[model samples]
Target: MTDFRLVIVSAGVSDPSSTRLLADRATQRVSSLAEKRGHTVTTTVIDLRELLPELPAAMSSQLLGPRFTRAVDALVRADGLVVASPVYKAGLSGLFTSFFQVIDNDLLIGKPVILGATAGTARHALVVDEEMRALFAYLRTLPVPTSLFASTEDWTDKALGARIERAGRELVLLMESGFARAVRDESWDSYQHSYGSAGGTELDIDLSSDMMRLATGGSLRDSDDDPFDPRRA
Candidate 1:
């Protein structure tokens, strides 16, 4: 029963937002599990709609600097994260997407994030899985195996409740693993930044020359290896 904090990123309107509902349910499941383990749990809920015109896509990085900074801070300080959003026109809400895009990717590296979403039908569930995973991938976050999706019908569905419980457990397990490994690996991650700046692979000089040689009928050679023979290693 260690102390753990969970952050919910919900992009939903103030009304009966299915996004926040699903997120709340998921958090409850995790909090219950935490209680059972005698662990204290704290939560910070950030509703993108609550963020207002400040969260507009184009200005998300600037106007919402404090909020955006808090979001990044939450990712760093929290043991795990649950991101829930309502689908919008076959895509994730712009607020959610922009919020993520503006952050420092290093904050999410190796963090366990649970992907969840709500929509009118079940058909869009897989979209969250694939597209959402891609986003986490870019952030270098380790996503849990169980992704939560709630269709309009799922709001009151019993099975959906069970699924939320399962996702919560899965997320907890991932975070626990991270906690254990992070202690040992934290040094490496922290010091890795002190090394050389982001390095792209060196230009393949050999390949470049080979291609040129082929393109010009062996005009380019391995000059480094054999200057006279016109062949460079």
Candidate 2:
């Protein structure tokens, strides 16, 4: 038996939309697969529509206020990730891109992700196949094959159900495969090297004794507030 967790995110702007369909199908696919493997599965859905948007600058470094930070924590610990979006202009939705761009550290790195998308016609279905896959690739997520996609025309049809079922089986194989490549088994800190990485070098990491990390609490350095543990000027 394995432990699996899935975070289905739909960064759709509309109130009643097909993006949720993509997310829901992905969730169902994972659920069915978990049953076959006897894996304990937990699911969390982050509907960007429901989340009040924080400033772009605040989340630009993977430190997404409180809500997204916790979401990151969960994704980092999960065995699986399935993310979907509504393609716009041959690419992912801007809302989804914003969510993706801000992450300094992709918590789901090395976890298997099922890339999915819903669009108006089959013409853009390939966007799901190409764009979302590349996005996950950039995040270093293991995007599984058999992407579950549906254009507006196919949602209610019987073939859609069959495709979803097929995707479910693929997801099962994905879970088994991802379990063997778990990143936690390796040192996470090693991945932190390289230019433009979060917080830069060790010197960039200011070790303040104050018990605050985010601007929401207070500024890291305030002329009025006494600063430092005396170890560094």
Candidate 3:
């Protein structure tokens, strides 16, 4: 049986947080589904609350503490991710956005993600698609078609469970298809990547490119080859 690693990033601040509960439920569903398909799943959970102490430093100065470093390491190895955050002011938690903002942009490229959110009122149910989806899109993650959103009332509803199962199945199928790995292996160069990104695993640098040469104070491209050059104009 093949093995996969799943990382759950929970932005829950309370001891018994519904946000984390939603993520855990999704995790359970994913694990069960992967097992049914003859695959083994290993899970690593990164509780954002635990990174609060380092959050300010990370946000302001891009300083990664031990906890932040560990989170990044976990994500770098994750085959899939379940990211859940509590809704605040009709949007995702600041902690959730802040954590993702500080990480390397290339880290989650082409990775499959399951977006989830928990809120007290159903009025905020749209936050998952309206807000969370946009964030993951910007990160260039492949989010499942079904997203999970649980209000206090939704927790007891059977629909929530069904959605969790659907999202889990989609994630497993994507993993089995090796979409993320294929994208990274074959088409990574088609996407924008920064040096030392993706937890230092993204070491591919085109040192012979004109941009690299220009950055190193080398001679510019020939005026005939530069569309924007004043001489060409």
Clashing pairs in 1: 221-232, 222-231, 222-232, 223-232
lDDT of 1 at 213: 68
**77, model 1: CA deviation in Å?**
0.6
Worst 10 residues of 1 by lDDT: 194-203
lDDT of each: 0.72, 0.68, 0.92
Against the hidden true structure, what lDDT does model 3 obtain?
A: 0.92
Enumerate residue pairs that collide in model 2: none
Predictions: Cα RMSD each: 8.1, 9.1, 3.3
Tens-digit per-residue lDDT, 98-208, candidate 3: 999999988998889999999989999899998999999999999999999998999888989999999999999987888888988899898887788888788977988
TM-score of 3: 0.93
lDDT of 1 by residue, 1-233 (tens): 67788888898775888889888988998888877867777898877776565566436334445565566566567787889878877788877887777555455567777789888888888867878889988876777788888887887789888888888888777766765247426643442331221121112234454665667656554566556654443
For each of the candidates, give the backbone clash count.
Answer: 4, 0, 0
Ranking by lDDT: 3, 1, 2
Supply candidate 3's per-residue lDDT for 170: 91
Name the regions of candidate 2 deviating beyond 4 angstroms. 59-63, 178-181, 187-233
Once model 2 is optimally superposed onto the true structure by TM-score, how far is the C-alpha of residue 233 displaced, in angstroms? 31
